[model samples]
Target chain A: MTADMTTDMIADPSGTRSPGEVLSWSRATLEPALRGAVDTLPGSLRHLVGYHFGWWDERGGPTGSAAGSGKAIRPALVFLASRAVGGDPLAAMPAAVAVELVHNFSLVHDDVMDGDHTRRHRRTVWSVFGVGPAILAGDALVTLAMDVLDGHPATSVLAAAVQDLLSGQSADLEFEDRNDVVLPECVRMAQQKTGALLGCSCAIGASFAGAEPVRVEHLRGFGEQLGLAFQVVDDLLGIWGDPAVTGKPVFSDLENRKKSLPVVAALTSGTPAGELLAERYATADEDLPGLAALIDEAGGRAWAHQQADALVEAALCDLRLADPAPGPAAELTGIADLVTHRDS
Target chain B: MTADMTTDMIADPSGTRSPGEVLSWSRATLEPALRGAVDTLPGSLRHLVGYHFGWWDERGGPTGSAAGSGKAIRPALVFLASRAVGGDPLAAMPAAVAVELVHNFSLVHDDVMDGDHTRRHRRTVWSVFGVGPAILAGDALVTLAMDVLDGHPATSVLAAAVQDLLSGQSADLEFEDRNDVVLPECVRMAQQKTGALLGCSCAIGASFAGAEPVRVEHLRGFGEQLGLAFQVVDDLLGIWGDPAVTGKPVFSDLENRKKSLPVVAALTSGTPAGELLAERYATADEDLPGLAALIDEAGGRAWAHQQADALVEAALCDLRLADPAPGPAAELTGIADLVTHRDS
Candidate 1:
């Protein structure tokens, strides 16, 4: 993750970087521009946004540590996708910042909706600032994302992805109240919720690189598949990962009765264990570990892992189809592996 | 308000149209375009937005009436501003729709933040559809507003206004917990929250018409002053207007202990009534009528009316500075009168 490693990996055509190194480089390239854009926000919103980004404590002092700042995965994808299309990564800096801002905006609002209190090992924006200010902070971030684009041709691309993201979130909320959500619709919801923005990140990066539409579409396909894989891995982590590592309570998703992909698959499996799991889920039962066992017995765990592997493979296929530069393609592959394999 | 009257009024250079006629014409011209843009929203969000606009009932059926739809005042400003700049109002249709969408987006989110249950005689979007969906619907709308601009040169103008609007809202929420709020900052908040978008609507409309920057700035000045006047009138209405016409509970602002312009003015007036009002306001006393009387006794109401008159005069002076065409200028003046004088 050192500067020398980044330089060496990027300069050598045959060298590949780890996902951590790629993210480190991306964050280094992105943070200044990101902060500059955020600084343009009005003072009140600027303070809340900085707090949410883990750049400062709640009272606007420097946090003195980068403890809760996210992994910068989306911005990394944007920069790498630009480089894959043979563009200087700096040319796509605005796109990268916009994507990151949108991601954080969704995180802030989603925390309020989901009623979660923690993320990335820190108290969430709503938990600390109150819901009204949190909502305004989210609004300011999304607005700033568009303003940073400054009438670029990619504005429509970003807007469409935002629409899809909102629709996906709408569907996800609706699913919470309904007992009859099917597997296909749940999958579609996940794609809309998570895949759209990731796909947009790649497509926008390529477009910023002046890539042909075909290449941009392929890059988008690559990101969409990877995003689905990431979600699958995330769902698995939500259920089984160590609470300390994940920065969330153990079985928090189950406690909320979130219809994660694995849970939905288990509910619709038509196995005896699936029926038992459903009966337990309908009641106020608190046996989260037992429910996890039933989902495993219903083959949900295996199905999710298989989906992740297949999605990642498909994402790699799209990466190849985009005819990316070999070095960036290798780094993207590394990132995909990390996304599907990481514990948190 | 009739087709023949509208045609006759527009055709006759010497004849002037009423504000109601101007608004009717604006609504007629704006509705289809606004609906078309909203229809592009994903179905889930579209449903909620339509409900918010009073286009349909919660079940998605026609309301069988247009009883609760807003007056479309912002869209009227956009159109009139363009026409005043000697451009065909039709050319500014997208800007009109965009301004209207931003206005509604703010309204939906503001209702959630303000915790109001009703708007325009119906349950608010959040109250009817749940807060999460309401927030999503607002997000969809602002995104769509930017998308409607579609790389237009005016996108930055709209974006800046959105930022100001959000900042003003943030300050407003902050002020709710403080007792030492001053008159000047309260006025600045109103200018940011209400004046900015109105100014933006005028500026964007004129820009769409290819008006020079000077004219655009003048038009913006006109709108900003008018907006401040409108806010003062609205604050007055919030305290004293009939519930049937204003579509809100009587003395609602006092009930919420809202630090509205007139209330703040009275609170800082250094009168005995002001001191007594402050003491009563800090209590759980439910005497809203008594509170209203204290505000009036403290000179809040008369001061507000004087301010409104001065602001409208200032707005008209700016309109004259823009060198607007005579016919549209008359209509704009009419609309300004309506805004300052209306009961609702």
Candidate 2:
């Protein structure tokens, strides 16, 4: 399609490309293959799928949808891990495409289950096309992922990750009805919901490279820790990041009453702010700056930052063990740091 | 696993068994593997999956649940087609289990989509577990199916069938809200919704037997035709069969305003009855006996029966090119007849 889609992360054989370039290159390289896999559906369904990808509008004409095709981080893991393990990154296209497909599948279904009408600053699949088609489309994407990555290890790994994802989602839904969700349980949910696929993404890339079982496990751990760190940083951003960059009101998680890790931490802090926030949470009114101050007062923000840093350190440790190359290893570590340290 | 789950359809290799006995035997043989695969899920989710399989109740006990394990027809196709092609049906266990899982996945999602509260005389997965858990469970089953049956041909075929099934369902949902549905479109939709999975089941079995491409094609054609014929018979029974046998009120398709094949055909028949039926459909309060008389008077019942029989004959012709053994061939024909000719 485009020259942009032709550049691979491996173009930097001199070991000098920045991690941002690596992520962008991997996204560009994987774009055509992802589109090709999705375009195999029959006409009408293909249009609906394209709409979800933000490549086309409801009328199937390309224009003006603001839905960014995600950050491509998981797919980056796939390609980089494959190349790091001495395999051709291009040879791992199927694995890369599979993870991206599964990631989008989860996005569509989660939007429906959460009843959220908007994502990526655009209407969701269910909001646009209705629940029936949205559900079917989600199912189609998952099946197509398997269709592309057909065979052992990949299929089992993807399926097991999906299992964990669903388990995490199940717990998340149940948590909505209870006020007793602990930090560890919430962390486990995040690991399964967000971390499992990321971990599997790296494992799949390693498997593509014919890496040994232990090596694959290490790469998976690397990605798993990265995934958990991403969630923690995300939680911190939700609560404390600038409204201009984060695109939300300050301390919005407090108003939204989401059972985020910081909320769990603050509730378990046993401080007067914890009791006041809990009271406000039950009453649907928060003391704004006071609630924000209380979360910080209870060490929630600082704790999340520490956890995120620890996770990134753990992730880098595994990455060093699994990938001895200076270039790809540096790129992976850089991307991890960028995500953790990003204001938005 | 019990002795029941251990009995293969080929256990009666002596060729004395009726087709019904063959189906029952195959299902029994596949039961252990089926249970083993489902039991792979984590504890709570496993219980939910088990309940959907009619293996347990909401309380996770084994008794007092009126649910029947499904007819296992698609799975029987996998096992029987394998044996008919001179292979051990037992070796196709993975394929058989995969098909069943996909079928149940569709069932769970479909029940939620259509808002049908009960199936096979039991509450649906969603009705018991809520929509989110049910949706997750359905997704889990599909991923699990692909996981177990990973690899070329099988994975691609299953994935494609899943796509077709979703397309058919999308069309079916749209058809419900439209008034211009024609007979051919309805038939095509039925082929996708019901026929695709069946065709894939046979194809998977053939591939498991390492059959050549042409042989696989013929077996798939046979299964596809069989699936189409099944819809025609089911439509006929829904409209005109005896209430006691069909398990519905007399001529209930009219009462429900469902656009079944016969209704679609008769609405386009151009007879006085067709005009009257069309008008009555718009009004939504038709005289039951009069609507029934009109449909039959317009030759709707006869037409469906003819279509069913012709489709079976077409299916049989393909079977003739497939298994040349008199015994297994005759058994397949018998099963086809049993499905097509039954009132319910």
> Best-fitting candidate, measured by DockQ?
1
lDDT against the true structure, each candidate: 0.91, 0.81
Candidate 1 residue lDDT tens string, B155-235: 989999999999999988988888999999999999999999998988998998899999999999999999999999999
| Residue pairs that clash (backbone atoms under 3 angstroms), model 2 | A151-B151
- Model 1 lDDT at residue B56: 96
| lDDT computed for candidate 1 | 0.91
Give one digit per residue, the lDDT tens place, for model 2 in B223-294: 898988987887787677686565445665566677788888888888898888888877867587787778
lDDT of 1 at B9: 54
lDDT digits (tens) for residues A49-130 of candidate 1: 9999889999999999777778899999999999999998889989999999999999999999999998988999999989
Model 2 CA RMSD to the hidden true structure, in angstroms: 3.4
Q: Which runs in model 1 stand beyond 4 Å of their true positions?
A: A1-14, B4-15
DockQ of each: 0.85, 0.57
Off by over 4 Å in 2: A1-10, A64-67, A237-257, A282-297, B1-10, B64-66, B237-258, B279-298
Give the alpha carbon lDDT tens digit for every residue of A238-269 in model 2.
78877655544677666666677777788777
Question: How good is model 1 by TM-score?
Answer: 0.97
